[model samples]
Target: MTRTALRICPLCEATCGLTVTLDGDRITAARGDRDDVFSKGFVCPKGASFGELDADPDRLTRPLVRRDGVLTEATWDEAFAAVQAGLRPVVEAHGPDSPKFSASLEQGGTPIAVVLGNPNVHTVAGALYPPVLLAGLRSRSVFTASTVDQMPKHVSSGLLYGDPLAIPVPDLDRTDHLLIIGANPMDSNGSLCTAPDFPGRIRALRRRGGRLTVIDPRRTRTAKLADEHLAIRPGTDALLLFAMVHVLFEEGLVDLGERAAHVVQADEVERLAAGFTPETVAGPCDLPAASVRRLARELAAADSAAVYGRIGASTVEFGTLTSWLVDVLAVLTGNLDRPGGLMFPLSATGAAPRPAGPGRGFALGRWRSRVSRHPEAKSELPIAALAEEIDTPGEGRVRAVVAIAANPVLSVPDGDRLDAALASLDFMVSVDPYLNETSRHADVVLPPPPPSRGAHFDYAFNALAVRNQVRYTRPVLPLADGQPDECAIHARLILCLGGQDGADPALVDAMVIDTVLGKAVADPHSPVHGRQPDGLAAQLTGRDGAERRLDMMLRLGPYGEGFGADPEGLSLARLLDHPHGIDLGPLTPRIPALLRTPSGAVELCPAPIAAEAERLRGRLGAVPDGLLLVGRRHLRSNNSWLHNVPALMGGSNRCTVQVHPEDAARLGLTDGEPARLKGDGGEVEVPVEITDTVRPGVVSLPHGWGHDRPGTRLGVAAADPGVNVNQLNAGRLLDPLSGTAVLNGLPILLTPVR
Candidate 1:
C-alpha cells in the first residue's frame, strides 16, 4: 500500500495545521503537524475529527433539487440548471439588489467571482473575501458581521488611527499588563484573528512577568486565567472604558505628547469622559467604583499595556461606542501603535487588508415597525425588516435571495421572520453542504465540496493573527467522486447570474498550490523549512498549495518581500524533501509607510465616532427592567457549520438560557426548566440554566442553534436542537448609524413554559 502525508485542518478560525496518515487512499489517523510555524503542533479535538466530517453519513455527496415541493437526488448539471432557472427571473424582475448573500468569517471558501459578479450580495467574511468582492459589487445594500458585531472596533480604530482596519492587538508575549473587556479569547480562540494555542500564550504571559485583567459579565475561561476579573454589567463596556480614560486624564498619567498632535476632538473626549467618573458610571455598570479606579491606575503604571474587546463589545446596544472607547483608552495611554501595547498586524500578501469598514454612524429614535423595523445603519435596513422588504408591495423589494454558507433562519435576528421572508421569496438558492433551516426553503441547494478538497488560506485571519506568520495546506485527499471543485461550483453559479468570471479557475488552483509551496520554500521564519521539506510538502499539498502561493505572492506581492522572501531560499520541491512542520517567530506590530489618511499621523478620536456618542445616548435611554437579551459563545461550535460535526457535538448541551439565580427565582424557573423568551417579532422556549455567572435582569442564550428543519440530516443537531435565539432577536431594533442589529441588551419578556 502507498502512503502520503498531508496537513489541513478546517475546524475554526484557528485553522491549525494537521498531518494525516494515509494508507493508499484511506486516511487512517491524524496528528498535529509538529513543525507548523503558525499553530506549532497545537491541534484541537475538532482537528482530529476531519476524517469524520469527510466520511460522515450526513455529508452531502450529491446534489439535490426541489421539484413540486419535494427534494430528489439529481445530477450536478440538472441541479445547476434548476438553480439558474429559479434565480434568473428573480434577478431580472427585481434587479440584482433584491438578492442578499451571507457567509461565515471562519473560512474563505466562497469563490470571489460569485460575490463580485452580483451587485446585490453581502457576507460576514471580513478583511479577506469581502474586500475582494466589495471592489467588484459596489452595492449600497450591504450587510456584514462587522456592523452587527465588530463595527465598534472598526469605528474605534478609524477614530484612533485614521485607518479603520488598523485594529490594535494585545501584545501578549511582550506586554507587562493586559486589560481585556467584553471578550473571551479562550472560547473564541481569537475573534478577528487566528490565535491557536491561546491557553499556552496566556501561560507564557504570566511566565514573562505579565499580568492580565478581564472585565466581563461572566468569568469566562480567559477571565479565569487573569490576575483579576471584574464582573460588570453587559452593554456598559463603553462607560467602563470611558471611566478608565477619565482616570488616565485626571491623574496626569496620560502620555499626551505621543498623541497630542494627532488627537482630534480632545476637548470633546475629555468633556464626555469627565461626566463618567468611576463613581458616576459605577452604578449603571454594576462594578465597584474603587476597583475601577484601581484598575485604571494599574494599567497606567504598567511598563506596557494594551486593551482588547470583541463580540461582547460589538453586539450590544452601545456596541460601537464601547468599541470606540476601548481604542480611545488605548490611544490616551500612549499605547496605540506601540510595541508591548496595542499593535496592528501586517498582512503578508500585497493585498490591502482592512479589518473593518467605516459605515454610517448611529441614527436616533428612527421609525420602528410594528412587526420589527429595527433601525437602519449603513444603508442596510435592520434584518428584522427583511420579511417586510420581501412581502410589502413596493419598488426595489427583496424578491429573491442567494445565501452562501449562512443559515439565517437559525443565525440571524428574527429567525422566524427571516424564515417567512425566505419562504415568500420568488426565488432562492443556498450554497451549502447541508439542507439547513434556511436551505430547506431554497428552490435549489448548491453544495460545495468538503474543506479537504479546497485550498487553505487565512486571508482574513492573517491580518489579525496573534503572531505574524503564514502557512498553507493542501487537500490530503483528492476531490470526492462527482463533486465539483468548490471554486468552479461558485464560478458557475456566478456565470449563471449573468456576470463575467474574474480569475481563471485553473490559474487560481495552480496559484494556490504554488503559493503554499513557495511560502514553505522561502520561510526563513520556519524552524523546519531547512530541515523537513517532505513534511512541509505534505502539508502544502493538503492546503491545495494556496498557502505557499500566497506567501510567494506576498514576497513578490505589492508589499515587497516579506520576512521569508529569498530567490534561493525555498521551493515546492525543497518542501517535498521534509516531513515535519516549520516554525515562524512570534507576531509583531507593523505600520506601513503609507498611512492613507489625509494627514500621515494617526487620527486620535475622529469626528464620526464623536457623533455616534450622541446617537447612542438618544436611542437606548437606559437598561430596561425586563430580561435583557445577549448572545454567548462556545468553544466547539463555529456558527452553523460545526453542528454537523459529531465529534464537536458529543460534549454537553451548549444551547441554554443563562439566567441569574435571582432572576430565575422571580420567573419561578429552575435549572433545566423551559422558559419562553418573547420579543417583538417572535418567541422561543429554551431550557434554563440558572447560574450566578450572569448579572441579574440579563439572560444569555447561545447563538447558532435551533435546527428544526425536517430535511437536514444532522442527527445530533436535530435530536438536541436548542431555541433559535435570533428568532426572538428582531433586526428592526438596530443601531441606525452602523445598520447593525442589536443582538444584545434587547428587552424581552420571559416566563416559565408550563
Candidate 2:
C-alpha cells in the first residue's frame, strides 16, 4: 500500500517541509509539501533526495562493539554493556575533581565528554538528549561544532544583548535593502537565520525593488544574484565593517531612532570608529573607498536596511568584532527592532513574553580548556583544542569521549593528529547511523535508526526562523524490529553514564517533567502558578517519553495553551491537528523585553568588542601576500554527513580546489591537473578547477571531505574519497575572543604537482 507522510527535511538549516511517498517500511519518494506554512512547496536538492539518503545501504542497522580490537556487530544489550564497561573506569579513575576552572588539575570522577556535531540541531533525539547525557557525565571539557562554525556570533550576541540566545536576524521579506557579508544564503538556503527558499526570497526582494548587496571573497551564487558583489579580502570583514561605521558617523548618518532611548555607549562607538576610515581600510579589505562610502550612504538612506554576516565572517581572526559590527551598522541606521530591519524571531516553542527587565546576563570564560586554557564561550571549549586535551598528559586531560552524530576527523582541523588522538583514548563511543571516519575509532558505536523511522521537529531552527512558525512530523516508517529509535539510543547512553545501565528511559523524561512543572507552579508568572506537578504530569499527552516532553514544552511555550488557560493556544495535540504546520506570523519589534543586559539596554560598544577593534586597527597596514584559502558550500551537501549517500555526490558536489584562471596561471596550474595546496598544518594534492568565480589571489575548497581513512565502513564515501580541507588547518590560528578557527582567509602556498 502506498501512503503519503509529512516530514520536515532534516538535511540542512532550511527545515523545509517534505511529503514522503512510503510503501510499508520503505520511503519511495520525497517532494515539497505544498501546504507547508513556511516553505510553501519549496524544496532544495538535499530535501528532494530524502528517500535515497534514508535508505542508503551504508547506514548501520545494529550496534558495533570492539571485540579483539576489531569492530563487529553486537546486540543492543552487549553494546550497552561494552559502553558501561569502557566509560565507567575512565570516569572513576580520571575524572576532573571539579566542574569549575583551576590552574592545576585534581582528578576524581566523571571522565571528559565532548559533543561535536551539527546534527544535534537537526533531529529530535539530537536536540533533546545530549544535554541530559552531558549533565549525567558532568565533565568540564565540553566541546561543540559551534566553536568551529558559529561561536563568534553567539559571543557577539551575548556581549550586545546580554543574552547569547537573543540573536537578531534580518527581516528578509520586508527589508528595503539587505547587505550580506561572507554568507551564501542561496547555497546554504539560509543558516543561523532560518528562511525557506532563500534564493526565492532574494528574487522576491529584487522584484519588489529592494536593493541587495553581497560582500565576499568569492562571487558565490548569492553574490551573483546581488545588485553589487564586493569581493573583499578574506579576514578583513571587521575592517570593512568598521570603515562603513566610520562613513556613517563621518557623514552624520548615525541614527538610532527608537534605539536611542534603549542604547548605551553610543559615544564610545563613535570614538572606536574615529580612526577606521574608508581610506585606511580600503587597502586591507580590497574594497574601494568610494564603494565603502556609497554602501554606508545607501544603507542610511534606505527605507529599511540590515547588515547580516554569516560563517565566513564568524570563523576569522576578528570574528567577534566583525559580528558585533554587523549589528552596530544595523542599529546605527535605525533599522534594528523595526519592520523591514533586523528583528528577533519568536518561536512557538520559545518561552512566553516575559516582563521586560534586567536578567542574569550571559557570561564567558567561566572555565578554560585543560591544555591551552582557552576560555569557554557559551559553556563550550574551542573544538580546535580537542586534540591537545586528549593527547596532552595532565591530571584532568580528556580520557574518554562520548561523541554523538559527530565526524571531527573531517570537520575539525588537523585531522591526522586528531585521528591518532582518538585511537589513544581510554574509552570512546559514538552515537551515529554510519561507521564513518570518526565512528570507526569508537569502542562501541550505537547506530540510531534512519530519519524515516524517527519523528521530526525543528527545535533549534524554529527559534532562528525568519518568520515565526511551527511544524512537526511523526515517524514515516515503523522502526525495524530490535532497532531502537535515536531517542531510545540516547536515553540508554545517558542511563549508562549515570550508572543506571538498565533503567527505563522514560524515567529520565518523567523526572525532567516533574522538575519543570514544580518550578513553573511556584512562579507567579506561570499560568498554572498554583498547579501541582503531579496534576500537570497527568494532563500531558504523548505516545512516548520524547513526545510527552514535547507536549509539556509546547503547552508552556509562548504560543502554547498554558494547560487550558488559553484553550486554542499551542500544544502537541494542537500541532498534531495541523499536519502541514501553523504559521504564527512574521517577526515583530522585540527590544526591551529581549535585552537581558545588566543595564536592560543594548550595549552597542561592549568592552571586548572595542578591545578587539583596536587589534583590528593594528592590522590595517599588514596585509599578507599569498594565496588565501576559504571553504565553499555545496547545494547538495551539509558538512560530512551526506557524502555517504550516492545521490548527493555528483556534479558540482565533487571535491576540487576552486582557483581563478589568473591564480592558476600564476601558479602554473592547469585545469584538471593536480596541485599541492600547502597550509600551516599540512598539504594535499587536489585537482584544480580553474574558474573566474574566485578572486585572483584566493583558492577555495569545500569542507567535510577526506573519507579515505582505513577501517571505515562507509562504502560509497571511501570509494573515491575526497581530500579533507580541514587537514590544512593545524588548529593553530583562532579568534582570541571566541576561539573560532580561522577557517577563512588564511594564507596558504600552492604549487603545481608535476
Tens digits of per-residue lDDT for model 2, 333-440: 999989899999998877777788887777877777766778888878888988888888867777789999899999999999999999999889999889888999
**Candidate 1 runs further than 4 Å off:** 1-4, 23-28, 89-138, 256-265, 352-385, 499-552, 558-589, 592-594, 616-623
Residue-level error in angstroms, candidate 2, position 178: 0.8
Models 1 onward score TM values of: 0.83, 0.98
Give candidate 2 regions above 4 Å deviation. Answer: 94-110
What are the lDDT figures for the candidates, one per model? 0.63, 0.88
What are the root-mean-square deviations of the candidates from the true structure over C-alphas? 7.6, 1.7
How would you encode candidate 1's per-residue C-alpha lDDT over 25-105 as one tens digit per residue? 566667787777777788777678777776666767788788888877888888878876876655444333433222211
Q: Least lDDT summed over 10 consecutive residues: which range in candidate 1?
A: 104-113
Query: For model 1, what is the error of residue 504's alpha carbon versus the real structure, in angstroms, after optimal superposition?
Result: 7.8
